[model samples]
Target: MENLSTIERILAAKQSLPGALLPILHDIQDALGYIPPDAVPSIARALNLSRAEVHGVITYYHYFRQTPPGRHVVRVCRAEACQSVGCEALATHVQSALACEFHATSADGDLTLEAVYCLGHCAVGPNIQIDETTLHARMTPEKFDRLLAELRSKP
Candidate 1:
């Protein structure tokens, strides 16, 4: 399958280096949107690790997803600081707006919503990051709508 070849190519390129697991996983996810579940065995074998170890690493990192992801991802911080500043309220607004739950993608495949522990913007809590690239802090329902509109505008 295509996925197998991709895994092989990545392994060929990165398996020789020390600490290769994370980088290999990242590359696979970057290329394929998510780490395919079947990738575990190949990855484990290449790195001479147990499947449990590979799977553990994947599950331990919230950033590594095991399923196919939506076209866009929205991560809302739920850290203590963010919560103290109404991240819950913002999360509620995001859920309502997207009609999607955390750890799930929108019905139309428009976006995936997830709760992240932190984005390191404690000074401006209630931060939300779009597609892991854009960080918006001090979020309000109104701001969320605007951002959603901006996302919809993109191809």
Candidate 2:
């Protein structure tokens, strides 16, 4: 899979849909781990869209990653529900402990920290999503550290 480029993956996924710019992009990201710079041209040609149009979509969505992500991604919910529960303080603690700001990966490459609008856990408040798994309710700084440690130890 390492030898397979983003263009190849995008072309392969393009066959499945008639007008699949979004889906193709999703699959390309899923396969390549991130949308490479080279993919813009290939995707544009395949979808008959301008290069600028393709780039615009990619840049517009925060979910799209231009660069490769770390092994683990940690997303903190920053919606009003979470904010009322002191999520800002927790976010600061997490950033300080990891030594990285929001939307950035740690220097060790163990984690990528991102801010999310909501996690649908408003009642619990101060929610976090680790990778594909969501953790709800009362997120403390210490608990976050334990979760980070657990993710770091994974293969």
Local distance difference test values of all predictions, in order:
0.93, 0.84
Local accuracy of candidate 1 as per-residue lDDT tens digits, 45-141: 9999999999999999978999998889999998999999898988999999999899999998999999999899999989999885888989999
Model 2 lDDT per residue over 30-135, tens place: 7766888777887887777899999999999999999988888889998899999999999999999889999999999888999999989899878999877757
Q: What's each prediction's clash count? A: 0, 0
lDDT, model 1: 0.93
Question: lDDT of candidate 2?
Answer: 0.84
How far residue 54's Cα lies from its native spot in candidate 1, in Å, is 2.0
